[model samples]
Target: MRHSIAIVSLVLFVLSMALLLTLAKQAYIPRKEVRDLAKIYLNTTYNPWNKKFTAMSPEGVTAIVWDYRGLDTVFETAVFYLAIIGSIALARGIGKYSKPTSDEKKLGLSLIVKTVTRITTVSIIAVAVSIALHGHLTPGGGFQGGATAAVAPLLILIAFSQYFLLERGVSKDLMLVIRSLGLAGIGLTAIAAYFIGVAMNKYAFVLQNQAKPLSEVSIPAYIDGQLISGTLWFFNISEFFAVMAGFTIVLILLVIPERAFKSSGGEEK
Candidate 1:
């Protein structure tokens, strides 16, 4: 039975690779001419001479995601937030992971893996921060950076054990707080310019990045002469924390052994 399954898997893998290779000839190739909507974005994304229309970010993709179609991104973020909340509700009061139980004392991988994780985890976190913070100037943005940040804790959980993180005060409650704050920050950043407009009695739109022709209100694109690209930088940083903590919460909950829950008289969700 095992050999039969293996033969089927091999055939499936071969077929998938062959199909991908065929598509690589044409489907994945870049088109030379600019399309209509894409051309509009490329022209206005970082144009200082066209501040009223521009998102004022070097990275066109980030501008499009957070500025051009921001409301759509907000809805997507809300869906992820709701999913996390649902998981937390389902997994309530199952375990306190501050210290390991006797059965867990012998957990974690070998010393070589642990040592490598220690080095790589810190570097990975640094890269994630840079990716989120500099997203308006480069390729990556909030979701990408947050996903990258989550990998560090995941590696530590596998390599050095969950107790290592628990001992270091990386608890679910703390993560929840961080996640909540990040979400709040994103919300505030979204409406910040609108509130300013109300106070000054000028026209402004929610999620507005650069000042439009009708509204003089604008989120500062620069801070102390540094190009933060208005709401894009704040959104990226907030989302980085929110996604990182949310994913870490999921990991911590998932790492709990079934036997552990059973022993504690907690029914599995």
Candidate 2:
């Protein structure tokens, strides 16, 4: 009887969740209506005579995430970094072992790998830079771009092992460094916000607008609802670096083997 009751309870819980999700999915109004409402709610007229910015609304979403909500993002990044550093420290350490190593299979392999590495490295760098620079104007920004930048190193690592790069190694310490820098940057941004005597959302907008001069610069509704400030670009950049470093660390830990070389088949002993 108890088991049956528990099963019924579980079913009820699942059904409730399903109902909520369905409601949420169907909650949004039609796009045309939404746009019309936005126009009505957001449309503002310049009233210099009354010294009033009448009907002015901010880019609320940008403000919330980058400014007011930035603290959350900062702590989140901090936690992310802490986790990454911990993993690096735990997984990679001072150890020694030997195994057969080789890149001796084909003459063209070295050339191909080298070419691919160079092309990929350069291309990724360019893309990252572009994304970072135009983060405000377009969809992607620094965080996305920076993460993309991190890929270049991973590619290089794949093409050439630590031995080739003057004994460069990816270990726990390196992860700590990358994570530390990222977290530190985020912390500093937060601290700066406090000193500015404004909430995170407000600050994000101030900085973002300062960095990029957009004709239609207004805080989104979400941001207007809070104190976060900075252009969405800044937040985007932060996310980019955060994600980039994260994936890079994961790639190193997972893909870069202890022994990066081995013998090919059919070798005469």
Candidate 3:
């Protein structure tokens, strides 16, 4: 009976998908002209005439993310924070793990692996920072850069051990603080315009940049003749730190032993 039910369900699902595809094809309408909104964004994205509204980023995607749809990005960052918080909650007892002995701390890969990791880690972090900082000019942004930076810590964790990091003062608590500071920076950047407007009796909105009128808080697009995407740079930098710290915390928690929970008299769900 179970097998018969499974077969029937599979057949129904397939039939539904087929019907949906056929209906979609039947209802399809071809368009020769570009969408009005798409054309407008394309035309104005990099145009000097639209400097007030245009993010100087040559990359349209970065402009849209950091300028046109900033609130969406802010919410996305918040969602990432919530996910990290959930992970921390789920692994509440892991932090109670006793410190490993000096010998146990050395129980990692050989000298060759450690040497290679040390050599590459700095380069990886540098590239990630470059990606993040150049996000407005290029394709990548804070989230991407932060994820890239995270590879360094992960490499260290694998090449060495958690105890090695702990001895060096890289703890979950420190990461949490870093993450919090990053998030705070993001918030401050987002509302800086609003606060400035209030202080100066001008009109402003949250996340307003050079794109909007009465936006007294302006980040310079060129600092000493060097191109910088202003608020976009700030956002990317904050996001890089937040994401890097959050991921590091999560990785550390994952590597913690299950025995730690039991030893600490903490219940497992």
- In candidate 1, what are the lDDT values of residues 80-174, reduced to their tens digit? 99998899888876643334556654678877888889999989999999999889998999999999999999999888887789889998989
Query: Taking the tens digit of each residue's C-alpha lDDT, what string does model 2 give over 1-269?
Result: 75998999999999998889778896544554556644533342211132122222144333344544555755666677677667666665424444236553432237778778878888898899778655544445556686788778677666755334324565535654765565556555545433443543343332222221222334332354542223354456556666676767766666544342222222334
List residue ranges in candidate 1 displaced over 4 A. 1-30, 93-105, 266-269
Worst 10 residues of 2 by lDDT: 44-53
Which digits, one per residue and each the tens of the lDDT, describe model 3 over residues 113-182? 9999998998999999999998877889898899999989899988988777888999899999999999
Q: lDDT, candidate 3, residue 21?
A: 79
Each model's lDDT: 0.90, 0.53, 0.83
Clashing pairs in 1: none
Alpha carbon lDDT at 246, candidate 3: 99
Using all chains and alpha carbons, the TM-scores for the candidates as numbered come to: 0.85, 0.54, 0.81
lDDT of 1: 0.90
Tell me model 2's lDDT, rounded to 2 decimals.
0.53
Cα RMSD (Å) between model 1 and the true structure?
A: 4.3
The best candidate in terms of TM-score = 1
